[model samples]
Target: MMKMNDVAKLANVSPATVSRVICHPELVSEETRSKVLEVINQVNYKPHIVARQFRTQKTRNILVVVPDITSAFFSKVLRGIEHVALKNGYQVILGDTENNIEREKDYVDLLLQKQVDGMILLTARQDKVRLEELSTQFPLVLACEYIDGLNVPTVSIDNVSSARKATEHLISLGHTKIAHISGSINVILSRDRLRGFKQAMMSQNLEVESSYIQEGDFKFESGYHQMMKLLALEVPPTAVFAFNDEMALGAIKAAKDSGVNVPNDLAVVGFDNIKMSSINEPSITTIDQPKYEIGKKAMEILLKLINNQELHNKKIVFKDELIVRGSTRKEIDVKETLEMV
Candidate 1:
């Protein structure tokens, strides 16, 4: 109900002085600031955010493009992004691409339309040239997944290294016949993880069997079905490493359904230490990617770009930890599980 002019009129000060007190408090004297604050509180005056945005050519909002919003993995990262955005006096616009390139393009159009100030893509499948062109003109930050050879600022862990370590953990537990449940090979993240799994196997003089590897789509159903296929093998793998938590959880279910106990008959390890991984029946062993910190760092990078601040660095990679859980433990004897099966 109360505009800046109304407050200015009541306070007997010019609108510009009121603006100074509200927008640039340091420009106004302490006495003036105190008086304007008193009147603002008394009249319950609220500045028009839309008008401010229009004048400044800034929406004070950022877009976050997620490949799949339903996954808890992204949700935690989003929380971190939101935290940083709010602290910096900005709002977040979430765009769930549903793993569809077309949907991601639609969201990108919002940035081009000036509907938002900037964007952070969690996973991208857009044309390389187009993305490169857009990055040159806009404030875009890629998180978790990145395009190789592109200088786009990114925040993520070393997927390949983490995956290798996960497989090495299984090997350390005396699992000779290790299987891999891979995410789609199209994405760099998946490919890097697969490469890491292979590297670990080679380092230990273990044979990376083609029959033991199953392709998944980074989803529970795919993981479940793949694990089922592995179970039917004449000589099933003694351990399995899944690209993500959902797939790993599915593998656990599939193993149980086939009368096999996890970490006993079949050790299971996964990437992304999602919350469910810790609470699952036989809790999953996984690589703990700093989900929240990744989001926070991505947002911080985007803000720096938005404000035209000099970036201290372009590429930021976080470290990951391999957490040992029930799923990969040796407490349950393999012989006992085999006899039960």
Candidate 2:
């Protein structure tokens, strides 16, 4: 509640002296700095975020745009972003765009209008050209998902490689008729995942049936419905790979309803080792994407940009791990943490 002037009055110093002590302690005499600190501690003085923003031209706030705030996968990332921002004296403002382009644009306005100092996008809804333009104007970074040819800072795992790893796990179980439940092809990650599944399938000289690849919206209901469709086929697939954990869980439920035993009759693999994937009836065998680390790295990049510092690298890719659980093969569930710095 105490103002800088009040602190200066108590310390027998000018306001500028107090400012110098706080902003650049190295430039201020140790005696002056000690006096100001003693007064500040006595009064429990705190800097006004708004006033500091006015002086520095920074909001001290970050905007994080997420496609679905309810997603547990993104929740981990959000926590990672908040952990760094709050530690740096900045608060995070979360915006849920619901995967709607128009809604996303509305939140992007906050960054364009300078309501937030910088922005971190956790979803992939922005156009490539628009992202390029925004990067030239604002401090922006992409997390979890990224756009190709944008040259903007990005932090994510290799979707294609992760997907291939997941599929290869299923293939190692000696399942030849492996099916894929894909997320929306509109998103590059989804396409990359599908491509990986195909790549793994071809490596084994297995045929990819067009009917086995069902399009999903990265939702549980969509996964369940798609699994049902795959099951109804005259010759159903022996195994399935889902792009996300939610979809993978859905597929498991659908298979159970169809009187199929998981890992025994139909092996299922999922991406994004969300919390639920481990506790589910059949623990999911998934690719750990290091969601939390990715979030933290994205915010770190945004901070560098907001400070007008040069980036050592434009793209940051994290490695993913394949976790073996009950969903794919019946054994002692072995969990692997996706550790990336």
Candidate 3:
């Protein structure tokens, strides 16, 4: 029940001096600061955070827009975002859009209404005009997904090049009959990855079969179903490159159910090396995206924007690694890894 005035009286300082000591200590003399701190400890006073935020016109809350919260790959990224946000004295508000445009707009409204300080968008919405307009209006950063025309700061890997490297790995292993399972065609990353797969195939003088390319929705179920269709082909593919780990695992399961031996009869490669990929029956060979690093870097850039600082780069690309595992070649024993766990 102690107020700022009460602390001021105990410290024998004016109310304004007490306010300066509490909110902006650098503005007050060190002697005055010491007296205020001593009195504050005796009173055990806590600043009213909400009232302070209102006075400064800042919520100190960041809105992170996610396409799907259940995604294992995204979970790591979210952990990174939360870590940076907390360390920087800011709070994160997750906006799980579930790939819904209406829900995305709702989060945008929150930012426009001054409910949050800034935003980091993980969902890649195709509304270029809207995004571009918003970029000029407020502090915005895109992580894991991006649009070309927008001048907003973005943190992402080169999807096309990463996909190309994965496909090339399969080709180096002498796989001529290679198939591709891509995320939805609407997504820019999906399209870039598919383009990379095609580039790798053409480099080896192999035919890019129409029947071998399957479009999926970046879900486990879709991966399973699309893979089944690929398996049903008259001339089944010897290797498959899936867009994500979730879909890649699904493809592997389908191959097993159909009595196909993985890496022996059918080799599989996937993007986004999520945690589950390492412990699965056949540890998946995947493109290792720096998921946590991406989130950390994105939040860092958002903070720069929030502080009205100039950014060095608007489009930031991180490196990607191709990890070889049992799905492509024997790496670890599933039973042994499980036992270690």
Candidate 1 local Cα displacement, residue 192, angstroms: 0.5
**Lowest-lDDT window of 10 residues in candidate 2?**
332-341
Specify the highest-lDDT model's number: 1
TM-score of each: 0.88, 0.87, 0.86
Q: Which one wins by TM-score: 1 or 3?
A: 1
Error of 2 at 101 (Å): 0.9
lDDT (Cα, tens digit) per residue for candidate 3, span 1-341? 99988998999999888877655454678788888888988989876878867666777789999999988889889989999886565789999998887899989999899889899999867488888888788899999999876777999999999999999999999999999999988889899999999999999899999999999999999889999999999999999999999999999999999998898889999999998889898999999999999999999999888888899888989999999999998445789899999
The runs of at least 3 residues in candidate 2 whose Cα sits more than 4 Å from the true structure, single-residue gaps closed, are 5-50, 331-341
lDDT of 3 at 204: 88
Per-residue lDDT of 253 in model 2: 94
**Per-residue alpha-carbon lDDT of candidate 2 for residues 1-341, written as tens digits (9 for 90 to 100):** 67999999999999998876665454678788888888988999987767877786877788999998878899889988999886465789999988888898999999889999899988767778888899899999999888877788999988888899999998888899999999999988999999999999999999999999999999999999999999999999999999999999999999999999997889999989999999998899999988888888998899889888899899999999999999887543445233421
- Global fold similarity of model 1 (TM-score): 0.88
After superposing candidate 3, which stretches have Cα over 4 Å from the reference? 2-50, 330-341
Full ranking by TM-score:
1, 2, 3
